[model samples]
Target: MLHDLGGLLFIALGLVLVAAGFVWQGGALRPLSTKRAQAAAMRDRSRNLLRSADMAIAEARRRAARDEPAIVTVEDVTRVACRHYGHLFVEREEAAAALRQRYEAADCRVDCMTDAFN
Candidate 1:
């Protein structure tokens, strides 16, 4: 009977340790999941900015084709993106910087360093 009791006590301790290990693992994974979510959000923001800049470029091209005084310049991509996604940025400078990066990638004529908006 004593031997049986000893075995049961060992089993109980083993089970407790296993449960603790699971809890620790769960805690560790939580931060990883949070970081993944943050990265996903950042990617989505970048995609949206790029799409907006592309659309602005296309609109400018269409106007030039029609010989209509181009209402939107390549530099205006930043302004257009900011108008749509302004809330995503913490500051005007941040919005300008992000939009300008996207605009340059989309082949805007103005250099990122010189263009105030694009």
Candidate 2:
């Protein structure tokens, strides 16, 4: 499933780039810029975090049927997602200057910590 998703992402990205090249004056293919690659990696990591949460929640649900105390709530999955994805954005609030810049560019808030996503 992961491999298929990755292949799709690359194919979509390739199609977009081709369209962009033709729309612009020159139809030349170029390597992704450092910032573009980093952004893509960040999104992929975020997606992976969500996927992990989905799997965890599903497992918890399966267990919940047999055990009453093992119920998985949205908070549980969201916290898991936030913690994992937050680390990718900024491991430390005070020191993640680059990440903060990216967030600002995207017009979104990315405060350091799991609370942002949660």
- For candidate 1, list the clashing residue pairs, or say none: none
Please tell me which predicted candidate would have the highest TM-score against the true structure. Answer: 1
TM-score of each: 0.42, 0.37
In model 2, the clashing pairs are none
RMSD after CA superposition, every candidate: 8.4, 18.0
Q: Pick the candidate with the highest lDDT.
A: 1
The residue ranges of model 1 lying beyond 4 angstroms of the native Cα positions read 1-32, 65-91, 110-118
Model 2 deviation from native, Cα RMSD in Å: 18.0
Candidate 1 lDDT by residue in tens digits, 1-118: 9999999999999999999988787564435587899999888777766676567656666656443433444346556666776733434464456556655675555422234363
1-118 per-residue lDDT for model 2 (tens digits): 9999999999999999988878896744896799999999877765654454454445554665442533434444445555655543323332233333333343433221222222
lDDT for predicted candidate 2 compared with the true structure: 0.50
Worst 10-residue stretch by lDDT in candidate 1? 109-118
